[model samples]
Target: MIEVYTDAASKGNPGKSGIGIVIKAGKADVEYSFPIGTYSNHEAEFHAVIKALELCKVQYPKEILSFRTDSKIVVDTVEKNYTKNNNFLPLLERIQELSGHFPLFFIKWIPEKQNQRADRLAKEGIHK
Candidate 1:
């Protein structure tokens, strides 16, 4: 299974934002960081997952995927397969659609300390 760690950050609640992702498959690993324009922190978090999944679909098609994130809200939203918040409906739908391409997909929530690498990359992206 391919393992992926992702994170996102916004300079302000709805200010400059960025996304970071780290993908590990066997002995190989890759990292990505990019600016995501202005969005809320939560929105950025969702986008990070979307970006990571998009990359995975292209690079590791038909493979099982295990994704880790620091955002509990994202994890819960994905796990439950539903979200009551209307603003997140589209984002959640996109995630669900991306996940369907993989034979198996799992999303886990880790503490902030455990997700430092992706967090740092996300912070760096904010200035780009």
Candidate 2:
């Protein structure tokens, strides 16, 4: 199983945003922080998961995915596989599609302090 921790930070609502991801695949641990243009904080959180899945699709295709995030919106929406927010629909669908490539996928919600590494990386992205 691959363990992934992800986070996002936006300067403002629908403003400059980015995503941070930390993936642990066996002995190899990787981290990523990338700008995602302008999006709401919720949208950026969803994108972090999306980008992590996309990366795993190529790097760890057969591995099960276990993701951790501080964003309840991302965790709840992914767990239920549904969201009423229109802006989130596409992001949710993209996650579902990406998740299909793995044998199994799971996401858990954690407190913000528990996600500090990813949080710092996300903030780093915002300034870049």
- Which candidate gets the maximum TM-score versus the true structure? 1
10 residues in a row with least lDDT, candidate 2: 24-33
Looking at model 1, residue 116 earns an lDDT score of: 90
* RMSD values, in order shown: 0.6, 0.8
Clashing pairs for predicted structure model 2, backbone only: none
Off by over 4 Å in 2: none
Residues 40-123 of candidate 2 have per-residue lDDT tens digits of: 999999999999999999999999999999999899999998999999999999999999999999999999998988998898
Alpha-carbon deviation at 98 in model 1, angstroms: 0.5
Q: How many residue pairs clash per model? A: 0, 0
The lDDT for every candidate, in the order shown, is 0.95, 0.93
**What is the alpha-carbon lDDT for the whole of candidate 1?**
0.95
> What is the C-alpha local distance difference test score of candidate 2?
0.93
- Residue 60, candidate 2: Cα error in Å is 0.4
